[model samples]
Target: MNKRLQLFSEWLQEQHISLAFITSSPNVFYLSGFYCDPHERLLALLVFPDEEPALICPQMETARARQAGWTYEIIDYGDADNPWQLLERHMRAKNIKLDRIAVEKSHLSLERYEQLQACFQARSWLNAEEKLRQLRMIKEEKEIAILRQAAELADFAVEVGVNAIAEGKTELDIIAEIEYEMKKKGVREMSFATMVLAGENTANPHGVPGLTTIRKGDFVLFDLGVIVDGYCSDITRTVIFKSATEEQKLIYDTVLRAQLAAIEACKPGVEIGSVDRAARSIIEQAGYGPYFTHRVGHGLGIELHEYPSMNAANAMPLERGMTFTIEPGIYVPSVGGVRIEDDVFITDNGAGILTKYPKELIIVS
Candidate 1:
């Protein structure tokens, strides 16, 4: 068996689970090396305790499944037919009367879950949602390489956005310019919608770009990310449209300091919550605690948001090879907001900042 499968088998043994159904796109891709088409039909990747592997997919996707580089016993069903019947038949062929079967709770809909339960009739059905999550939390060398490439592309997109910002330009125009540059630079898609907030709109962390025109002396917040090689990179930076006011400068400085402190505190063996606390403390001390509303950051990989979240509530320890972001912001109601974000890779020695964009306040006229 391959390294990933081997690790998964070990985990399954530890959990006393003999059969597992991985249906999430990322998990299926990780195990079967197959990327499923986003459709209404459900595809399942099944791993048994001792068998090789098998896949239950729609008949339409059989060709693509074969080309996914991994060999598996394929059971393809057509539309207007039930796929769970095929699943039940496969289990009988293996002579595997599963006493306990694990399923992805978060990804499985209630209707599907009910169908699965009626079909399988297992002794126990357990939620193994975190099994794949735990496996993906630690980055392999190849995953890190892809993420580095994504981060570089995101940095380039930011540069393009900075240059595109000018007086009289609409927020939507700036977003279009940044997205165009990202695609031109070879990014196939964005991890999320590009956020282009100007003036008071910056106070909203997730403000959508609109027809509002960029004006002089307004703070423009740009939060963007690019998807490259199935990996994602996220970043946020605020720039003055023309020049900064005294209040804007102070808020910007506080956010930068908090972000820097959070990045500095990231290291192996530390609790994930510590990273958020380190940044939150700085903002709170500066009397902008409430303004800094969101969590410090989140994990980045095949999915934009993954395991080992950087939040005060998370208890997961930071381990070497973990990749996440450190984003701290201050959003005042009427005044503009400032956020400085960077992607960091945890190393044995410390954290390595993957993003290269300058954190110093940028004044554009």
Candidate 2:
């Protein structure tokens, strides 16, 4: 079993839980090293307090799971088989007993929970969501290495997006070019939807990339990431289409300052909220506090957004090996928004930046 699985098993033992059904794709891949997104299809990892864990997935994924180094028993079901029924048979065959069970409350649907309850006649269900978050928050050396490579690809993607920008190009066109180049370079998937917001559309933090045309003097934002070996990288950068107005330049510089300060505050043992405050204070001092609507950053890794949300109310202390994004933005309605984001990790010394793409305002004509 992987160290992550062992850690989870130990937690289960401490809590006196007899069985655990891990259903989330990210969590499953984290513990098993085999990645599978069953979508609406059933996929689960059954863990025991001391016994070897078993994976229940589609038969099609069994070969991939074995190749990923899964040595434990695998219970795979074909389309004709009811996976849950198969699960019961497999557990009975293995003499597995479940008086009470644990589950990922956040990812397990209500229907799935009902099915498990009927199948096991469990006495109780404990939430293992927070424990799994804690386990995955700390990045191992191997994870960090993969994340660095992912960050490098994210930086390259930004470069591609910027280079693809032109006066007459639509946001969708730019996104297509960026993603096409990523495929050419062997990026298996983007961590999330690639964002390319142009002109006034940039004012919306989560604006959809569309047919909005780019124009000279428009501020274009590129927020994107790529998955590398199951790890993920997230980054954001905004540049002027041709020349930036004075007000636009000021907004861009303020956001950059806040991002830099937030990145600097990512030292070990520091309260996470203070880091958010450090950036918010900067933007507030610039008289754009209300315009900056979101938190300073969020934990980044297996999934695009994970644990340790860097918001004003979170008091968790930063620990070495914790990786997350440091992104600060100011979006003024009727005016464009400026955001500077970088992937960073907590280190013994301080913050270590993984994404090295230039943060200075770039003007492309």
Winner by lDDT: 2
Give the alpha carbon lDDT tens digit for every residue of 1-365 in model 1: 66787788777778888788888888888777788864889888888777777888899989988887767688899998778888888777778777788889888889988887787777887887777888888889898888888888888888988999888899999999988877777777898998989999999988878999999999998898887766889988899977788989999999999998898888888888988999999999989999988999998888889987899998888899999889999999989899899989999989998889889999996
Cα distance off (Å), candidate 1, residue 98: 1.7
TM-score of 1: 0.96
- Output the worst ten-in-a-row residue range by lDDT, candidate 2: 91-100
TM-scores for every candidate against the unseen true structure = 0.96, 0.98
Tens digit of lDDT per residue, candidate 2, span 114-222? 9998888988899988899999999999889999999999999999999999889999999999999999999979999999999999999999989999999999999
The best candidate by TM-score is 2
Off by over 4 Å in 2: none
